[model samples]
Target chain A: MYAFEYFAPKNLQEATKAFNSFNDSKWLAGGMTLIPSMKLRMNAPSALIDLSSIEQLKGISIKNNILSIGAMTIHADVANSLDVINSLPALASLASGIGDPQVRNRGTIGGSIANNDPAADYPSAILGLKSKIITSKKEIDAGNFFNGFFSTSLDTDELIVKINFQIPESAIYLKFANPVSRYAIVGIFLSKYHDEVRVAVTGAASCVFRVNELEEGLFHDFCSSVVDKTDYGITNLNDDIHANSEYRRYLIKVMIKKAISILQKK
Target chain B: MRISLTINGNPVSEDVDNRTLLADFIRNTLGLTGTHVGCDTSQCGCCVVHLNGEAIKSCTMLAVAANNSEITTIEGLSNSEDLSAMQESFRRNHALQCGYCTPGVIMSAVDLLKNNPKPTEEEVRDALEGNLCRCTGYHNIIKAILDVSKAG
Candidate 1:
C-alpha cells in the first residue's frame, strides 16, 4: 500500500476543507473498498479524508413517506434496521447479502454507490427504486448519478450526504453471487409501484441499468411467463472470470423467473 | 499520524504511518500477534476483530481510520485462567487442526452471538462465511458456535 497522509474530519465543513488542501485526496467513507484497492495498488491517492467521524452522514430514517438513509450508513445497520425492514424489506435483504458479515459491518452505502462497481448491489437499489442521491451540494437523480462502470456524475471532492429511496408498493432483489467475493454476477432488482414497474439489472452490463422492455412488460402483465422477453443482444455486457457474457444474459432470465415467482408468493 | 484507541481494556495512543493497517498496528506495533493476517486482501477472516463492538476486517481498515474506536483482539477475549465461552466451545468441539483461522473464527463467532444469541445451524454457517477454515471443513466450528448459542 502507498504511504499517504490521512485526516479524519469531524464535520462536513471540515471534510471539505481537508479535501481542498490535498491535491489528490480521496474521501474515505467506510474504507472497505478504497483501502483494499490501495493495498492492491489499483488506487494511489496522495491523501485520504476519512469521513467516518462525520456525524451528519450516518443514519436511517423514514420521513415524508421516503426512506432517507445517510450515506455513511453501513450495510449491517441497514440489514438490521427496523425502519428499513418495515419500509423497504427488499433493500434490507440486498444489504444483508453483501460481501460477508465483516464487510457489511464496515462497507457503507455512500461508498458503494460512489464507487459504482458494476457488480455492486446498492446501485441496483438506487436505480430500481428511483432513489435520489443527495450530495453535499445538490440532489441528483439516480439516473443521472451513475455514469457507467466505476464512474459517477459526482464531482471530484463533492461528497454524497444521503440517499432518498422511493418507497415501492412491493419489490424483490435476486442475485447470482460469486461464491468467493459475493459480488453479484447478475443481480436483478424488481420494484412495482401503484402504476409503474421498475426493473434494474446489475453485473450483466457495464452499468446498472433499468430494463425498460422488462419494466414495460411487467407493468402490463406482472408475471413470470413473459419476464424473459429481454433485449440481451446489446453489444456491451459485463463479464469477468466468474461468468461469460452469454451466461450472464441467460442468468438474467433465470433470475427474473425466480424473482417474479418470489414476488407472487409474497 | 497519531492514533489513539482502547484495545483489550487498555488505552494506547501512538504515532503511526498514514497507510498502516489496523491488523499491522495490532500485531506489530502493540505486539498482539493473535490477530492473524492470512490474506491482506480482506478475503480471509483471519484478520477479523471487534471495532466498536462490531466485527470488521482489520486488514481493510487503516489504523488512523480506527481513530478513537474501541478494539478487541483474540488476546482480549480472556486470560489464561479462563477461556471465553466460545473458546471453550471450540475446544469441546475440536474445532481446529491447523488453528490458523481459529482466532478470527472465534472472534467472528463471538460477534455473531453478541448480536444474535441463539443462531440455527444455517445461520451459524452464514455468519462464518467470511472466516475460511481449510481444516475441519467448518463442521466442528459450526457445531461449536451452535452449541454456545444453544447454551445461552
Candidate 2:
C-alpha cells in the first residue's frame, strides 16, 4: 500500500470536513475490501478517513416496525444482534454467511453496500426489503441507490450513515457461494410485505436486480411451486469461469425454490 | 506517523509508515515474530490476531487503523512459563504438522473459545474456516478445539 495521511474523525461533520480537505481520499470502514485493494495497488488514495470512531454510526435499533442498522455495524454484530435476529432472522442468517468468521468481524454493512460488489449479500437484502439508505446528505431509496458494477449513486464525499429496513411479513435469502472467496455465485433474496412480493437476485449480473416476473408470480401464489414453474430470462445474466449465464439462470430458480421452502417451513 | 496502542497489555507508542500493515508492524517493528504471514492477500488466515477483542486478519488491516486500540497476538496467548489452554489442546491433539499455521490457528481458536466456551464440533469447524491448516488436513485442529471446549 502506498503511504497516505490518516484521519480518525469522531463525527460525520468532522469526517466530511477531512474528506473535503483531501484531494483523493477514501473513507475507511472495516477496510475489508479497500485495504486489500490498496495493497494490490488497485487503489491509491491520498488520505484515509477512518469512521470507526464515530459513536452514532455503530448500533442496531428497532423503531416503528423498522430495523435501522448503523452502517459501521460489522457483519458479526449484525449476525449476533438480538434485535436483528428477533425481527429479521433471514437477515441475520445472511450476515452470518458472509465471507468467514474473521472477515465478518471487521466487514461493515456500510462498506459492503457502499462498494456495491456485484457478489455482495447486503445489496440483495436492501433491494428485496425495499430499504432506505440514510447518508450524510440524504436518504436514498435502496432501489435507486445501486447503479452498476461496483458503483452507487453516492457522491465521492457522501458517507452512508444508516440503513432502514422494513420488517417484512416473510423473507429468506439463499445463495450458492464460491468455495474460496465465499462470494455469492448466484444468490436470491425473496421477501413479502402484505400483498406485495419482491425478488432480488445478486451475483448473476453486473448488479443486484429485481425479477419482476418471479415477483409477479409469487404475488399471485406465494409458494415454492410458483418459483419452480417460473422461467428466468438469461439475456443479460453473468457468464464467468465459475458459472455460465444459463447456469446462473438455473441457480436463480433453485435458490428461489430453496428460499420458498424455508419460508414455507416458517 | 506516530501511533500508540496497547499490545499484549503493554502500551507501546512508535512511529511507522502510514501504509504499514499491522502484521508487519507486529512481526518486524515490534519483533513479535509468532504472527505468521502465509498469504498476504487475506485469503489465508495465517496472520489472524485479536484487535479490540475480535479476531481479524492482521495483514488486511493497516497499522494506523489500530491506533489507540487493544491488540493481542500469538505471543500474548502464553508466557515463557506456561502455554495457553488452546495451545496445550493443540499439542495434546497433535493438531500441527509443519506448525506454519499453528499460531494463527491458536489465536483464532482462543478468540472462539472466549466467545463460546463450549462450541460444538460443527461450530468449531465453522469457526476454523478462516484459519486454514493445509498440513494437518484440519481433523486434529478441530479435535483440539473440541477438546479445549470440553475441558472447559
Candidate 3:
C-alpha cells in the first residue's frame, strides 16, 4: 500500500479526536475494500485512524420494535447474534450470505454501508426495512443516506455510530450471488410494514433503489400473483461482465418473487 | 510500531512497520508461513486466521490493529504430539492436494465448528465459500470438514 501513519485509538472519543485533527485521514473499518484500493494505488490516505479498537462500534440490540446495531459490527456477529436472529432473521440471513466465511468475519456493517457498493447486500436491507443511519452527529433516514454508487451523505469527519431498523411484520432477502466475489448480481429485499409493502432492489442499478411499481403491486396483492403479471423492464439496471442489464432486470423480478414467496410461507 | 497480541496460546510482541498487513506480519516477521496469501484483494480466504477465535481475512487487517487480540494460525492447530481433529480429517479425506489453500480452509473450518459444532452439508459449503481451491474442487474439503465435525 501507500505510506501512511496508522493510529490505533483505544476508544471512540480518542479516535474522533485523532480523526478531527487530520485533514485527509480515513477511518479504517475492516479494510475489505480500502486495502485493495490502496494496494492498487487508487487511494493513498496520509493517515489512517483505525476504528477497530473502539468497543462502542461493535454490538447488536433490540428494544421494543427497533433493532439497533453498532456500525463496526461484523457480518459474522450479525449472523450469529441471537438478538438479530430473533428480531430480524432476514437481516441475519443477508449477513450470512455476504461474501464468504472470512469476509463475513472481517467485513463490518459500517464499512459495507459507508462504501455503498451497488452490489452490496446491506444497502438493500437498509432501504427495504427503512432503517436509520445513526452517525456521530445526526440520524439520517436510509433513503437520504445513500447518494449514488460508492457515495453517501456522510461527511468525512462523521462516524457511523449505529443503525436502527423498524421491525417489519414480515421480511425476506433474495440475491443471486456472484460466483467469484459472492457479491449480489441482483438482490431484492421485500418487507411488509403495517399497510405498506416496500421493495428494494440492489446490484441491478447504480445504487440500491426502491421499486415503486413492484411495491405498489405487492401492496395491492401481497402475493406472487401480482408479480406474475407485472412487467419490470431492464431499462436502468447495471450491466457488467457477470451479467447484462437484461439479466439483472430478470433476476430482480425473480428475486422479488422469491422473497415474497418466502415471506408468505412464514 | 510495536504490536502485542496472543498467538497460538503464547504472548507475542513485535515491532512492525506502519504499512505491514496482519497476514504479512504473521508470515514474515513471526515466520508463521502456514497462513498463505492467495488474492491480496480479500476476495480469497487463503490468508484466513482466527482473530479472537473468529475466522477473518488477515490480508485486510492491519498488524497494529490486531494488538491485544488473540490470533490462531494453522501452525497452532496441531499440538506437538498429535494432529487436530480437523487436520486428521483433512489428511484422511485428502482434502488438500497442492496444500496452498489448506491453512485457510482449516482455519475457517475451525471457526465454523466453534460456532456450529454440527453444520449441515450446505452450511459447510457456505462456510467454505470464501476459501478457493483450484485443486480437488471443494467436494473433498467439505467432506473433510463434515467428517471431522461428525467424529469430533
Candidate 4:
C-alpha cells in the first residue's frame, strides 16, 4: 500500500468537509475490504477519511416498526445484538454467517453494501427487505440505490449514514457459499410481507436482483414447491472459476427451494 | 503519523507511515515477530489479533486505523515463557505439523472460547474458518479447542 494522508473526523460534518478537500480520498468504514484492496494495488487513494470515531454512525435500533442500523456498525455487533435477534432473527443469522469471526468483528454493513460485491450477503437482504439507504446527502430506496456491478447510485462525495428496514412478517436468507472465501455462489433471500412476497438473488448476476417470477409464484403459493413453477432469469451471471454461469443458474433454483423449505418450517 | 495504543497490556506510541499495516507495526516496528504474515491478502488469518478485544485480520487493518486501540497478539497471550491455556491444548493435542500458523490459530482459538466457552463441535469449526492450517487438516485443532472448553 502506498503512503497516503489519513484523517479521523469527529462527526459527519467534519468527515464530509475532510472528504471534499481531497479529490481522491475514500471513507474508511471497517476497512475490511478497502485496506485489502489497497494492499493488492487494486485501489489507491490520496487520503482516507476514517469514520470509526463518529458517534452518530454506530449502532442498531428499533423504533416504530423500523429497524435502523447505523452505517459504521460492525457485522459482529449486528450478529450479537439483542435488538436484532428479537426483531429479525434471520437477518441476525445472515450477519453471523458472513466471512469468519475475525472478518465479522471488523466488517461493517455500510462497507459491504457500498462495495456491492455481487456475491455479498447484505445486498440480498437489503433488496429483499427493500431497506432504505440513508446517505449523508439523502435517503434512497433500495431498488434505486443499486445500479449494476460494483456501481451504486451514490455520488463520490456521498457517505452512507444508516440503513433502514421494515420488520418483515417473515424473512430467510439461504446461501451456497464458495468453499474458501465463503462468498455466496448462489444466495436466495425470501421475504414475506403482508401484501406481497419478495425473492432476491445474489451471486447469480452482476448485482443483486429480485426474481419477479419467483416472487409471483411465492405470492400465489408461498411454499417450497413454488420454485418449481417459477422461471427465474439466468442471463449475465457473475460467473467465475468457483462456479460457472450454468451451474449458478441451476443453484438458484436449488437455493430457492432450500430457503422456502426452511422458511416454511418456521 | 504517530499513534498511541496498548499491546498485551502495555502502552506504546510510535510514528509510522500511513501505509503501515497493524501487522507490520507489531512485527516489524515493535519486534513482536510472533504474529506471522502467511497470506497478506487477508484470506489466511495468520495475522489475526485482538483489536479492542475482538479478533480481526491485522494485515488488512492500517496501523493508524488501530490508533488508540488495545491490541492482543500471540506474544500478548503469555508474559513469561509459559504458554497460555489454548496454546497448551494445541501442544497436548498435537494440533500442528510445521507450526507456521500456530500463533494465529492459537490466538483465534482463545478468542472463540472467550466469546463462547462451550461451543459445539460445528460452532468451533465455524469460528476458525478464517485461520487456515495446511498441515493439521483441522481435526485435532477442533479437538484441542473442545478440550479447553471441556476442561472448564
User: In order, how many clashes per candidate?
Assistant: 0, 0, 0, 0
Model 1 C-alpha lDDT per residue in residues A120-230, reported as the tens digit of each score:
999999999968999999999988999987999999989999999989989999989999989999999999898898888998888899887778888889888876555
Shift in Å, residue A176, candidate 3: 0.8
User: Hey, what RMSD does candidate 4 come out at?
Assistant: 1.2
Error of 2 at B97 (Å): 0.9
Name the weakest run of 10 consecutive residues (lDDT summed) in model 2 chain B: B77-86
Worst 10 residues of 1 chain A by lDDT: A227-236
For model 1, residues B2-77, the per-residue Cα lDDT tens digits are 8899999899999999888999999999999999999888888999999989999999999988888999999999
Expressed as tens digits, the lDDT of each residue in B21-107 for candidate 4 is 999999999999989999898888889999988888899889999999999999889888998888899999999989888888888
In Å, residue A25's CA in model 3 sits off its true spot by 0.9
Clash count (model 4, backbone only): 0
Q: DockQ, in order, for the candidates?
A: 0.89, 0.87, 0.83, 0.91
User: Local error of candidate 4 at A205, Å?
Assistant: 0.7
CA lDDT of each prediction against the hidden true structure: 0.91, 0.92, 0.88, 0.90
Q: Largest lDDT belongs to which candidate?
A: 2
Q: Score every model by TM-score.
A: 0.98, 0.98, 0.95, 0.98
- Model 1: runs farther than 4 Å from truth? A229-234
* Real interface contacts reproduced by model 1, as a fraction: 0.95
Model 2 residue A130 distance off true place after TM-score fit, in angstroms: 2.2
